[model samples]
Target chain A: MRTASPAPSRWALRVVGLGYLTLLLLAPLVAIFYKTFEHGLAPPIEAITSTNGLHALKLSLLMVVIAVPLNTIFGIGCALLLVRHKWKGNALIDSVINLPFAMSPVVIGLALFLLYGAKGWLGPDLAEAGVEILFSVPGMVLASIFVSIPFVVRETVPVLQEIGTEQEQAASTLGANAWQTFWRVTLPSIRWGVAYGVVLTTARVLGEFGAVSIVSGSRSGETETLPLYVKKAFDNFEFPAAYGASVLLALLALTTLLAMNVLKRKEDA
Target chain B: MGISVEGAVKSFGDFQALDDVSVEVPDGSLTALLGPSGSGKSTLLRAIAGLETLDAGRVTIDGEDVSTKPTQKREVGFVFQHYAAFKHMTVFENVGFGLKIRKWDKAKIADRVHELLNLVQLPGLADRYPSQLSGGQRQRMALARALAVQPQVLLLDEPFGALDARVRKDLRAWLRNLHEEMNVTTIFVTHDQEEAMDVAGQLVVMNQGRVEQSGSAEDLYEHPANEFVMSFVGEVNRLGEDFVRPHDIEVVLEADDRTEEGVVKRIVALGFEIRVEFVLGDGTDVWVQLTRNELQRLELREGQIAFLRPVQAKSFNGSTPSDPPGASTPQGSDDGGDAEVSAAV
Candidate 1:
């Protein structure tokens, strides 16, 4: 015999949860937008359209374009290798894939610098070839990639493991070659997981700060991204421009979060 | 064409899954590989289908060697125990997958898929995905998908093992009928002896990765090759070195040189038959099945002494036999030699 919970207590619990979310999430989001246009929309719009501000937005988008696809493809490959094969040191390799998640992004940026910067390993040969990596777009992309490596692989591996190889085997027995089996059976099963991973990678690439900041050298209108622009405006006492850029960044984050929720609902359906 | 597995051996680490096993499944005949769990029946079936690579020996389908061929080229239809239908695909798509891969034309593929859905008795459900199907319907869809390629050999690894008993029985009859109509060489693995006996025209009994016996069900039941086959295929009473079935034992009031005196310990009424459990003078228990009318004529009662005689029994000179647990043990037995009477009927 079960009785319904009291309505007063249930209402109290709901109010507490909603209050916490409103205080921590809704209030800050609303405050940022409100502060961005407090003086007027003209100031924020002018600041966003400025050469430095526009270049910062373009650079951030460019970084996402360069980093997200590379990580997505490699992440899918790494996930397939981790889940579909049995070999020595598999546990060690699995742990190493998750190292980026545990380590600070700044540490990853330093490691990339040590490997690709001037006077670093392979730096002399790259210099001889007239290829610059550190303090350039390539270095920023590399840092973003390093920090976002674990998101896709972590999301895809469990899905691949759960969907097992039985359907693949059945396809093989039904006259499907390896490629056909993969394309027809395995890919469709893991498509949702891959899409979810891509969304996460996109979000992480767009908002990446610590590693990109260290690698980009924060040059104005050249390598400086949106987050860097926000920091530079704050340091230069350009409070309106900083608040406007922050508002834009917050909008992107909100859009990504909304997309994730929709994708999750679709996957569940 | 028939499937011939010649001295096939497969091993996973130190565990031998199929140890030099060989058998011939006649063309257009249905066969069953019957064994207990871990007896390598499923492994042998997979090896025949080329899903498992054999360490040694060869498999020939339709008189052609397929030992070196990959599973995709082997053209074998394999149905898994869990009915591994694609969750993302509808029944039509699942059934048409092989045809699509083989480059069948669109119209022809549609016709074949429709025919298969009809043949599997789920004609109107082709638009439903596997997740939307019941377990039995999913298995039927799996069967239809396997048959879509017109494979030379059909292999089912315990196809009905995951279904409920009633569904299993219904599907068993349906599969037998389908086999008759299709006339394709079929081999299925099952641990249920009744399933093997009822559905297979040819039965192959396996134990410990080796084939114990292979023949018609009636032949195997009537003349088992060894102790394992005797106990595995049917119910048997082991008195000393002789194995006898309950139906083959006769009970009488008088004791003779050929008869053993026993007291009835229990009587079980199983609708049409009455099973009488008796203990012999040497403390060996045996079961005898009699019709209800015969029980009334004899007026047998529990704890009453009776003389039991064997109508026919086979004597083997192999190692001592073991019985399944919960079998009635001999009362007041001091000797280490234990004989059991199985009441599997």
Candidate 2:
């Protein structure tokens, strides 16, 4: 990037690029901030600390708390399986892990509903046993988990493959068993990659709207998440509440972006 | 304790990496599994380390069979070509990993690790990570780590292969001296014959998944078992159908019956010896090696006829490459026949 080009053209290029970005990204973000704080911060604060707003925030975090860890474990295991192990349908399974990224979130939510809803497969037995999946906390958590599952795995596979098994072989020959080798050699080497994936997964969980919206049933104080509450407040013309929740989501996304950059620098180094 | 493989067999999808190969290393001696690329030297070394499994044989170290055991239980320290230094761990931690795995006391581990670091001459860099070290430093650290375990056997797959020439030579000598001091049973794989000659107490030349021959360096050079061994162990020229060492042929000026006539094509003074290329009467090119003293005595010139006589040339009956074992008869080091191919085009 440190080219020996002429000064004017370089400055022009920089100005043009920054101008485009400021217009598209920074402009809207600044607008969101301005409107959120427009009649002083008291109204947005009161709107956010309300019972429904607090419940929605708590519900969103709860989904993240459950789904991120579970998906992390699944992601690491799936990455190892796809990269290190050989199987009959490895190519097929590799393609299937990308389904969430390819499909719309609403489609995923609909698919989950059809699978666990009252009239769908495994639904009647669940209804009899009172295992509420659809229209419950579990439904929302499942949708969040489904959408964020590929982040960790996709990030980890290339890194695991890049490091290769030479060190693992060396560790084994040095009297370290399988578990020790993985815990010490393999895990340490892939930590940055896993962290990047975790950031993406966390971001997805915080901002996920469509899929969880379908399964959440949009309950007022029970199943409603932050994104749903934002939409509902906007529909009801509660500008302070909607902008307050939107600002919170944007802050969380920014934090994830910062974390992602730090991890990417570490991975590259 | 020395190591040995008995009737080892392995294949990777019909490409036989190790084909019923068996080798023995005398206790506490340095041996080299040397061959060209894809000749199964590394594969055999891995099988001995238990890093690779053999389809049909057993490996024994210190007179106990360990073929079925896992690599951890085999107690063989293996050094890889790329060093495989643990990037996440400091030099001290990397060297102490095996001891830590065995639950050694912290103080004891520190002492052992420092001792190894000193031995490999990487002292005072224990706190530095592998990335901070240079290429030679990393490999030296790998050696220190491998030797820290003090296993019954040590296996290296082209340990100096990734280094530049000067460093490789230095490391080869350093390794040889280290082996001498430690007296550990070490087996390293390499493709360079000179490296094998410089250090190994015994040389095992492998070709196409089979060990063509195994003996002392001088033994293999002087008494090759086949054409592959003769050609691969040193530079050779195909004088007619038989493989001839350049130094084995002598250039003479007289037209004698023992001499075959050839026009000198090129004469190169290669630092230590003079290499003279001759186009034989049959249009085959053959190189003859001479000392500066010998060249001066002959007074040979390019494009001039030179009558060459084979002296002590180790020749084979059938020197065709890719011939199976036992298909060719060994005419080297037996009957002491002169390599006089009389223009038999």
Candidate 3:
């Protein structure tokens, strides 16, 4: 039933918002912290410091390191392309940039596997070139890149469109070449948008699980990122490590959210 | 350097923004492209600055044809209509942007920027962001930035258009003075006839994407090329099929050969001049402007019978002699020499 409260009180709206977030997000987060510490701090700390757990954490961070820059660069290029110029397929390309958001991350991982898997398309040629793709770090990195594709572009496009091209035109008329104009005028004008986008992209790359897990073959030590490792710990009855890693991941997500909020405030200012 | 647009034509979908528009700006001259909204004045200015690529036609800067040159290579200085100040950059940075792009020395750039800031009368505001400046100050800052690189020509799109009336007046005077000092071949787009006359040496009147006329203020006022130019430049009184300047109508007591008789409707004695309204036998209104001394000499009064002579009435080919409004697209067929609708019985 769609109960429409046409004129809900301000306090009622606030209560609804807070209650939903608390029930859905905060309660689970608090339970995870409680579950991790139920056997005292020693168990979670030991599990986290274990070689497999440390490797998973390192792998998650590595994914972020590799994927974030590539996406950021691609995103800025895409936003500029979508905003500044018009071509035959401009709208189509604009829609394609946000394809990752429309499709499931698991599907993205599967698509990458289909293209780069050992027996899939391009897999044999890649193998002949002595390069491993699917079930490897490269495949996982590709999935991370895919899931995080939309963040920088989605954030930057509106900002680019809002700033308009007059400043860029002015720069050009003032004798600044195209390259100079981009570095001096266009880049600085869209810096905040790009910054927020980069942060979102970093968060997405770090949090990407479904696609990376599928492509990574759920390897234990080498390809097991933090999210996959957390799922594995839970499945194997390692509750302390599972909850501890989940708490760690939640903290990372919280930090990313705080960063995004700060960036948003700065942009508004 | 002199700039010219030869047969510039631009279109957007079904709407033709510019249609075979052409104008010339002589060297070290200030010219204004005056047109109503959607008349392609800004488009013409942008074309000259190489901002908008022409579908067909060529824009020549000075003697050389720079039609295909990029905006940067054109060596032109262009100021946007809204004063598109780089919000992130300080005044110093904005003014020095061109010089920096041309690879000027850091110290030299600072010196040039300071000199420009002082030139635009914006001293001590180099470190201030554009947002900190008022509308008038921002316009001057935009002008200063455009002038910093010693460009061959300067183009501005409604430089003072956003300012209040008083600020616009002040900036207009400042711009005229600045143009005199710099002597760059400058062309600015404006819809205000007074602004075009006050600030530019020549005015190009445009209507419906076609150039109606291009001449000096006196030329345009005394002898407008068409109905568009005649009406666009200054106030004109319509009497039957004639477009008569109010100043050209003389009121006399006695009847004359070239005079039409009418009863005086009203006389408004403005401080310096007098405006007399009259109703002819057909009940058509005719307005005439006169100096206070002229009114005193003629002894004009309200509700008095008078004989009015049209000393310099013009009939444009734009408006049909029998049906005036029938010439809706008069200027559209003008380049073929349809002539202006002027002078009739």
Candidate 4:
């Protein structure tokens, strides 16, 4: 006589999975918070008010405001061109759009340095026009944009490809012009994907350090962003100031994550 | 408007999706493009909608050359296989989308949307989103959205393909009534033969990117232009000599002495006729047709021989010599080669 095999116990499996995830992910987050506030909120409070630290925060926030919307429009344009049209070197163009995601931010900063730095390509022309790029605010924004280019494009292209061209065709047959078809049918269809791209791009720009550091010059009140400011405090052996700035950065990251979750929930709803 | 497509051919890479296709959809008539998957019926419909650019041919709608014009200028309404209802919009908003795109007055769009929703029998469901409605209800909403713009032509690609059989049948009837009421030049593509025959006033049969035949439902059913159309339109049986309608048969059972001595083989209930298939004296198999009343009068069983003769003799298109012979076989036994020799007659 044959016998049936026993099924796995649900409670045992659930406990193992829950324990592993909590240990790996939740424990680190809890540790970070505990270490930051162990002494007191006074250190974190004092560090946030420093002139250089506050200026860094303001500059980083300003960069995000400019970079994210600019990248969103650029990403949408690239996605539309790559998916909707055919031209020579189209595959090459697509590959180049994804180049930033694979290349090191340090290498990107070096390439920008070559183009705009003194004694480099286009360096003389930029100097003649009196446009200071390297070691300036514009240089910092450009570096951030380079590192964050692929985030929005990567999120958007797959969505547009999956949605296909049928909806636009239908709208056109209904007497909608090209612009109307795009606005009424195509854009609305990919709004969620675009929002996702924006959130991802924003996260990337906020967390970026290497490329911005190389181009920003670390000037105390001018080009220095918050991540560089944290590094400066650590380099000077100011542990309290460094840890305090790190905590503030963590909070900003957490807030971004919460906003993304809320956006995702709305998309689901 | 009457729509005419002449010698239209469209190809995607190596696959000839629509090859030398010609169709004339009469004004105010509902025509069906009926074919199996990959038969190019959908391609033909897309070409008419100006969605697919043809390699060669012209499409004239209402005596105007629409072949070169863009789809936006064609004034056609298209219902997709997936309903393609805007998921983010309410039923009212979806129906009024085209009007809004055209920048119509707000009041005009609202009134027009209301009228279309009422036409599709979803009056109070206007505020409901597409996800909130059932499959059948969503299909109706999509139809209303297509019609709200008062297009000159309405095209549907397998509109009922996604529905269950019961819903499909009901929608077929509803679509036919709606077509008549609207009296627009409507063309719909369907793989369902019964749906095509029941819903369309005119039928265009396509196969392998080419048109095989075009005619009324009865015309194609009675006389198919080729074998594919014959086998496609309805269930048909092909025998060795000639094909015959079961209703045209007369069965006489051979009886000994005072009565018929043959036993019934199989009695098939065919709504109006009882089909009897049995063996004859020469050990030949034959089938006969009888009225239900006659079948009731004479108890039929297995192992019976039916002496059969024709009530009428008509040659059917796609009927080869292999089929035993139509009811009237002038030349004796409908065995093998004899059927094809006399097929032309």
| Winner by lDDT | 2
Regions of model 2 farther than 4 Å from truth: A1-16, B296-305, B318-345
What DockQ, between 0 and 1, does each candidate earn? 0.89, 0.88, 0.69, 0.63
Question: Local error of candidate 1 at A240, Å?
Answer: 2.6
What is the alpha-carbon lDDT for the whole of candidate 3?
0.87
Mind giving the per-residue lDDT tens digits that candidate 2 earns over B87-111? 9999999999999998999999999
Order the numbered candidates by DockQ, best leading: 1, 2, 3, 4
Instruction: Give the C-alpha miss distance for residue A245 in model 1, angstroms.
Output: 2.1
TM-score of chain A of 3: 0.94
Rank order (by TM-score, best first): 2, 1, 3, 4
| lDDT, residue B152, model 4 | 95
TM-score of chain A, predicted model 4, versus the true chain A, to 2 decimals:
0.88
Question: lDDT for every model?
Answer: 0.88, 0.89, 0.87, 0.81
What digit string (tens of lDDT, one per residue) describes model 1 on residues B104-216?
A: 99999999999999999998998999989989999999999999999999999999999999999999999999999999999999999999999999999999999988999
lDDT of 2 by residue, A1-269 (tens): 86587999989999999999999999999999999999998988998899999999999999889999999999999999998998978899899999999999999999999999999998889989989999999999999999999999999999999999999999999999999999999999999999999999999999999999999999979999999999999999999999999999899899899989988998888
Model 1 Cα shift for residue B6 (angstroms): 1.2
In each prediction, how many residue pairs overlap at the backbone (N, C-alpha, C within less than 3 A)? Answer: 0, 0, 10, 17
- Total residue pair clashes for candidate 4: 17
Clashing pairs in 2: none
Chain B TM per candidate, please? 0.88, 0.89, 0.84, 0.80
TM for candidate 1 is: 0.90
Between candidates 3 and 4, which one is better according to TM-score? 3
Q: What are the per-residue Cα lDDT tens digits for candidate 4 across A1-269?
A: 63643456667777799999899978887876776677899876788788888898899888899899999999988888888887877799889988888999889988888888898898779989999999998888999889888777777888889888877887787788888888888888888888888888888888788888888778988888888888988899877777777778888888878888887887778
User: Residue A45 error for model 3, in Å?
Assistant: 2.3
